[model samples]
Target: MRLALVLAGRYPDLRGSQVLVQQLADGIRGRGHAVHLVTYGAVASGRPGPRAGRIVRDLGLVVRLWRTVRREAIDLIHAHNYEAAIASLVVGRATGRPVVYHGHNALAEELPLYFRARRARGLAHRLGRLLDAHVPRRADFCIAVTEELGEILRRRGVAARDLTCIAPAAAPCDAAAHGPRVGSEALVCYAGNLDGYQNLGFLLRSFARVRARVPAARLVLVTHAAPGALRRAVGPGVEIVRAASYDEVRARLDAADVAVSPRAERYGFPMKLLNYMAAGKAIVASAGSAKGLRDGVTGRIVPDGDEVAFAAAVVELLSDAAARARLGTAARHAVEDPRAWDGVLDRIERVYRNVLAARSAASTDPEASAPDGLGVAAE
Candidate 1:
């Protein structure tokens, strides 16, 4: 099948959505399907750029996307996020192609982070909710990164049959191959953006408690954000490192003794958890974000925003080498299981085939006039 993957951001960016888009394109191509990516030419930052600039760029993207669909005779359109989905819906309608919307995160929870002003943020969030409630309904099918997110979609009027929950997966990384250890100090690493939803303040307070118990333990944060910003957030005693590539992040994770994700959000899955699991590192993550993780099996799962418990979990794993090794091994094994990318793609491929089959059938029927609207189809 020929597929067009669409995203409303710069290609090959450091963001998780970019990583997911790249993975999907590669996976689809590896399965012998042709895939073309459509994305904005401009770079996007933590904050949204000028509204006028965004509108112009999006217009250009849609034009390019429509041309690609027509020229390539694309059979399916798979769009990521709201903006891309809107564009795909428009193109799919024009080209008579089915669209699959891949929802990475709940916009209602994420939109506010883009605006600095409280009033603007509130307005953006309200608009986000409206999009969330309406956009997926336009797609032929929807993919949610977590079951919690699938539930949110259902609440927003998306039918269960139209939704598939496929968590993100990470390629396996060998932690032992990355040269000698950087330092003897036991390193606890957090590899992601310092977004407000990440609960870094709680992480800092918890890490401070961990420092009290294990004075030699060090916190290493690997992100694209400025080191000064992280230093200000966590205060003194934390080391910040910026890694440009995934290879660098894996190397740093290889050097670390423990990985932490203190995200307080419940709607979406953290892509970093997959990296941590792939690195075979003992993880200390919040219960809400660590969806598939078992409390004492794959990794330690603490209640959200519980700094003392979160700190204790990290310190305990850091102190016990045997337990850390056991959990880390289990975490790696979990990712290597059938739920990994190979299996994930298997399910996604089925969705694509089903959508294609339904469309083919609908075209042959005299009464059928494009399979419009959103809802689940029988598996």
Candidate 2:
């Protein structure tokens, strides 16, 4: 089958969405299906320069997507995120093809973080909800990154048959292939964006408590922000490192004694958690952020925004080498379980086949009604 993967952001970007798209494209192609990527050439400059700039960019993206679908004779349109989903639906409507909307996060909860002004944020959030409610309904099928998100779609009136929960998969990490690594000081790393929903302020408070207990323990942040900017937000006593390439980030994870994800958001899954588990590092994450993780078996899960418990969990893991080792090993085993990338893509491939079959059957029978949007349970 020929597929067009549409993304609003730049292709081959460093964000989590980019990683998922790349994996899906590669996995689909590995199964002998043709996949073509259609993405904006650059990330949207967040500056509030002119609304006209964004309008023009989005229009161009839609035109390019339409041309690509036609030229490539695409069998299906698989779009990621909100803007890309809208564009895919437009093209699919024009071409009379089935479109699959991959819902990464509920924009209603995420968009407000981008605006600092109170009135602006309110307007943006309202607009986000409108789009969130309207766009997914138009797709032939919807893929939610987490069960929480799938439930949100259901609550918004999307049919149970129209939605599927397919969590993002982490690429396997070979801890031994990189050779013996010199261990650094007892370090805890948080590797992801510093957005408001990430709850980094709570992390800083928790880390401060951990520092009070273990003065020598260090807190390292791996993100795309400038060091000076992060220093201002996090205050002193923590190490701020610029985000590195994926390989370098994995290496850093391998070097750390404990990996931390302090995100408090309930609606979206944290991709960094997968990397920490794959690196065989003991994890301390908030309950909502640690999806698929068992409390005592895989890693330590603490209540969201509970600085006291979060700090205690980190301090405990840092203090006990044997316990950390045990948890790290378990975490690795949990992630490497049969439900990794191959299994994830296998389920997605089934979705493709089902949708195609339904489309074919509908085309052949004029008396038949529209195909039902069936949901595939996550493995």
- Total clashing pairs for each candidate: 2, 1
Candidate 2 has an lDDT of 0.80
Model 1, 142-220: lDDT tens per residue?
A: 9998878888888997877788788777643322233433554678999987666777778889999999989888898
Runs in model 1 deviating more than 4 A are: 41-53, 115-121, 172-183, 225-231, 366-379
lDDT of 1 at 268: 80
**Candidate 2: regions farther than 4 A off:** 42-54, 173-181, 225-228, 370-373, 377-379
Q: Report lDDT per candidate.
A: 0.81, 0.80
Residue lDDT tens for model 2, 262-341: 98777788888887777778899998899878887789999988999999999999888888889888887777764577
Per-candidate TM-scores read 0.89, 0.91
Q: How far out, in Å, is residue 125 in model 2?
A: 2.9
